[model samples]
Target: MSMYNEKVIQAFMSPKNVGAMENPDGVGEVGNPRCGDVMKIYLRVRDDRIEDIRFETFGCAAAIATSSTATEMVKGRTIEEALKLTNRDVAEALGGLPPEKIHCSLLAEEGIRAAIEDYRRRRQGLPPLPPRHDAVCHHEIPETGEETRE
Candidate 1:
């Protein structure tokens, strides 16, 4: 077997919080089909702080390790603190990721932010996050195959 960084191998081999929560206050799932990586995060919060976090992932070793590390980093942290977590942090915590697998760290970052957002919206009685305007596909034609501007 090829040698791997001890930290990365440790994280991948013995991931922390590596299960689903029974009743999570917030859940976030993100997948990158391009790379065949998917991550699902579950969190339980109290007093606007994360009390518990868990994750299930279907991806490469780096992806799994990132998700596992992210779960441990966020628990017991306030929403604000958790949001401050960056992809760099997770990668660094894991002793760094290979260039080819960097996107896995990004997915980990997105998963954490997404989970935090879900928890905030639920706690504040707010609605789901608004979709970005650019994400909308307006197929309606205005006149003679011309697209209409919203």
Candidate 2:
């Protein structure tokens, strides 16, 4: 049986917001050396909400799909709301991913958080975070302290 669901396939096949944004309010990048997957998220903020969002993911189908869906989920959301978006939420929105591929969702969550962090830093005149090789799956619980994978 195929591991990917219909929603996953659809998202992967025709991902939305799957490109770089010019003059973005913030940008964040992450990568995984083991799998050689890289992801960069861009944000355009208005007031306290995410006016727009985009992503560039170089990875598997799951990775692309998650990135696409994650951006859609947070496109018009407030920073606080977007910060609360979880990997599980992304997975669930896509009707769930395979056990082994759930990490892709984590990567999406990480990408979102990273981009927002950069935005906050820029707003505060602080330096952006150094590039970190912590993209796909660190397999650690998020700040919400809730387990994401099923």
Candidate 3:
């Protein structure tokens, strides 16, 4: 069998911030059963910054590793800064994810952006971003378990 990268394996085996929050300021979930990956991200924001982040994921090793590393990356980051984080950053932080599983990292990044947008909407007294327009829709999952486009 091919060997997996040490850091990727480590992060997957011992994920950081791997639990849900008691009362998260924002929560976002994304899944694609066609690919058999699902993730739920939780956040606690303070002064327009992410004070804490956590996640619960059901997927392969790459998905778990990406989510864990992403939670750490977002902590203490302003909403705008966190939104700037991309799947490439998450994969790079994990020493790179396999090409076939790259979507796992993308999912983690999407989850973070979704959570932050939700926080922003709530703070500004606006409704959540519509699923179709948000790029990372979380309001409604399609029957296939993937996000539906408008």
Candidate 4:
């Protein structure tokens, strides 16, 4: 069986908004220490909405696909709307992802939230938020059928 579905392959082959923005209003970067997959998202916000979004990712096919899908999901969406997005939403948008690669989708979700949070902090004249190191494994292991550590 194919490791990736059609939607995931499409996004990986031709990722949308792949480059970093020249002068982004906000930026969020997240990395998985276990897999060494890193994702950085840039946002252009106006009127509390994401007018444009872009991403740069260093990882496997699933990571690239997740970043591409996440950017597309949040573009033109209000901050409130974008904040509601979850890793499951990203995976569903990409048709689905392998159990082992699910963490990639979680990174994408965190990237968007971090960028928006940075934008809000900047607007309020507050310092940038610290890097996020929280675990992203809230899903059950498909192989062992047991809960994994965070």
RMSD of every prediction: 11.0, 3.7, 7.7, 4.3
Give the clashing residue pairs of candidate 4, or none. none
What is the overall TM-score of model 4 with all chains considered together? 0.86
In model 2, the runs with Cα more than 4 Å from the true position are 135-150
- Candidate 1 vs. true structure, TM-score: 0.79
TM-score of every model?
0.79, 0.87, 0.80, 0.86
Better of 1 and 3 by lDDT: 3
- List the candidates ranked by lDDT, beginning with the highest: 2, 4, 3, 1
At residue 128, candidate 4 shows an lDDT of 77
lDDT of 4 by residue, 1-150 (tens): 328888899999999999989988888988755556878899999998999999999888988999999999999999999999998889888877877788788889989999999888988999876666556633334565322222
Model 4 Cα RMSD, Å? 4.3
lDDT of 3 at 14: 95
lDDT of 2 by residue, 1-150 (tens): 337888999999999997889999988787675775678999999998999999999888988999999999999999999999998899999987776676778888988899999999999999886666763556433444343333
Candidate order by decreasing TM-score: 2, 4, 3, 1
lDDT of each: 0.75, 0.85, 0.76, 0.84
> For every model in order, what is the number of clashing pairs?
0, 0, 0, 0
Best by lDDT: 2
Model 1: lDDT to the true structure: 0.75
Better of 1 and 3 by TM-score: 3
Report the error of model 3 at residue 31, Å. Answer: 1.9
Tens-digit lDDT track for model 3 on 57-139? Answer: 87888789889999899899998899999877887887765555667777888889888777777778887644322344232
RMSD to native, candidate 1:
11.0
Those runs of model 1 whose alpha carbons end farther than 4 Å from true positions after fitting are 1-3, 126-150
